[model samples]
Target: MIAIVARSENGVIGKDGGLPWRCKGDLQFFKRTTMGRKIVVGRTTFEGLPPLKGREIFVLTRKPDAGFEGATAVSNPADVPADAIVCGGAAIYDLMIPQCDQLLVTTVKKEVEGDTFFNFQWLEGFEPEETIEETDEYSVVSYRRSGPSS
Candidate 1:
């Protein structure tokens, strides 16, 4: 699976249930990247954003019967596609990171107050394959697993 996220210098991704910063370009990047793929996301993350038009949305929630009008409800990570894109709020990121094969991150240069974060330790088991300076405020980096699969 692939994981995608945006975080600040201090690892902050959200504040008060939303992104701490407003970056339209990053959102566009996200949309373009995941447009034709399957995505696994937490309930809260699905709720915070509009439905992704062409992608299959898998909403992961603790509730066994949780339902969303346009999404498939999945209780376990095993229910998703092997190559699904794992998008998130912090809880989902925590659950899915270990299973990810690659990570696409947009890192904002400044630290921001936040209630959520991306906890993946970049250097532990991954190596950067490419990095693009998307803009002055943030840059996008792609990382592939460096060692054997867990």
Candidate 2:
């Protein structure tokens, strides 16, 4: 599985339930990487997103029967397909990052205030594979699991 996220220099991924920064390049990169893939997200994250075309969305929620308009509701991370992409709202990332084989992270160049943050320690098992895209505002890096973790 692959996990995709965008974090500020201070590791803030969200602010007031949305992105801390606005970067068109990062949005484009996210769309290109996740198009046509199965995406798993937490209930809160899922609720905040607009309809994503060309992708199957799975929401990790306590109420699996609550029926999301255009997404499937799952109670466990294990229920998500191994080939799916794990998107986040902190809790989901904490649960799914360990199961991911790769990570696509966009690091915003500036620090910003936010209530949600990503743990950098999660990347310890993964090694940088390449810089997929870079600009003055942000850079997207791909990381693959290394050693026994893979």
Top candidate when judged by lDDT against the true structure:
2
Against the hidden reference, what TM-scores do the models get?
A: 0.91, 0.94
lDDT (CA) for every model shown?
Answer: 0.83, 0.88
Residue-level lDDT of model 1, residues 53-134, one tens digit each, is: 9998898988849778789998877887887898887888778877887889999888999888778563358889999547
Q: Which tens-of-lDDT digit does each residue in 27-132 have in candidate 2?
A: 8888888899999998888877877999999999889888898899999777998889988988888888888889899999999999999899879899999998
- Backbone collisions counted per model: 0, 0
lDDT of model number 2:
0.88
Error (Å) of candidate 2 at residue 3 is: 0.5
The residue pairs that clash in candidate 2, if any, are none
